[model samples]
Target: MKYAVFTGATGGLGTLCVKELSRLANWMVFAGGTKEAELEKLGKLPNIIPVRLDVTKQESVNATLEIIKSYTNKLDAIVNFAGMTSFTSLIEGESVEAIEKLLNVNVVGTARVNRTFFDMLYQGHGRIINCSSESGWMTPQPFAGPYVLSKYAVDAYNDSLRRELIYLGIPVIKIQPGSYETNITQQVYENFDKTISNTKYYKKLLTKMKPLMMMELNQKNDSRRLVKTVIHAMESRHPKLKYRVGTGKLLAMLELLPEGGVDVVYKLIFGKQGHL
Candidate 1:
């Protein structure tokens, strides 16, 4: 039987992906990071196997490996949905520790998870889907520097991995989702508030960015299409190298602008405070 693994399986988008993938009768889904309570709530859905996996921890990775080995030796696909987000401003001299933490989870941790299952993926001629954000390509939003930096790294890592594994028939796919319904915005806002309270600088700029952040959060697109896009990437015989889901024409066009052009646009949008 075809088998797959999805890291960050308990997240908002991850949960949707898992539920939809479980409907595929021919495939087994190893829902990474799921808890016992979640499994019970799922009520023994066919082909959905909940496993306690955390990409950041070696022991958790090892346990997931053992669990997968007990069921199937090959993985047809591995979707990396695990990620970290933070609201940080470079001008504020954001915490080095926070930036490192995001990179470790969003970049290094993802690399480790894929490397652990590399052999199985090669044997199965599997595909890898990494869930990146629109921030991966677009200009960085104010006070969201750390999360944007991590996603930029994710984009580069996906490109390098795809090229590296090409000879082995293991395809790497990137799914860049635009604002979608998730708790990330809340977390980032909370972080921003905490940082502002603790810091002496960027207070006015941070305050200015608050309404914009709230507007962005309110604009979250339904993630159903993103889930379908991921499933297609997994099942398609010849999937595209990158899938940009939910990014509207405006944002899409903005991505084509030169860095200077984008910078101008940002300045216009948020006035002098928008300089990246």
Candidate 2:
């Protein structure tokens, strides 16, 4: 039998992946999340073991490791999806505490879980799948600095981790997905609202940015594509290092420009008075 653990199991993509994984024969899934009610629901599913995990806390990650160890000595796969997003101006609107919290959840949290479960994964020669975002590689936009910074860190962290783990015959895979229909959009909007309320200078800019942000969020693709890519990474004989699903061509094209050129583009978009 194969054993897998999925963090962020209560989330849209996480839940979809867990349900699909549960349908596979001889597979046991540990659905880890912070939501008690959602965990209870997942626990009712066959082959699903709901584990309460708050990846931002070391103790919580350690406790989850202990819980999983009780059931199996080894884990065939560990998929990390526990992440948070922020939509605020880094210099003027967002608090340092808020930025720190975002980093803790999206970057440190992922590392903590992987570190806590390393021994078990090593024992099984398993793979580590990290859910990064298209924002990780694309040229970042204004007001999304915290989230973009966190994802870029994830990308770098995963690259380094993969290089180290390759010697042990454990492949570390990264899934860089584009905007998808997920609860994260709601959280992003909430953060945006809070930023608007708190900002003294970026109010006008943020006001103009709102509709553009809305359009981007509304253009999200079905999240099932991401789930399918994740499953492919888990089950394939030789999975690629990175799987990019539904990435945006325009953002990607922007990434190819020189630093100065990109700066000019942003300046034109936001204008001298910060009106789009």
Best by TM-score: 2
lDDT of 1 at 186: 68
lDDT of 2 by residue, 82-147 (tens): 988888777774457767997899899999989999999999888999999999988887778888
lDDT for 54 (candidate 2): 98
Lowest-scoring 10 consecutive residues by lDDT in candidate 2? 267-276
Off by over 4 Å in 1: 34-36, 39-43, 91-94, 248-257, 265-276
Give model 2 RMSD, 1 decimal: 2.0
How many angstroms is residue 213 displaced in model 1 relative to the true structure, after the best TM-score fit?
Answer: 1.8
Clashing pairs in 1: none
Residue 178 in candidate 2, Cα distance off native in Å: 1.1
Give per-model TM-scores.
0.90, 0.95
Candidate 2 global lDDT: 0.88
Worst 10 residues of 1 by lDDT: 267-276
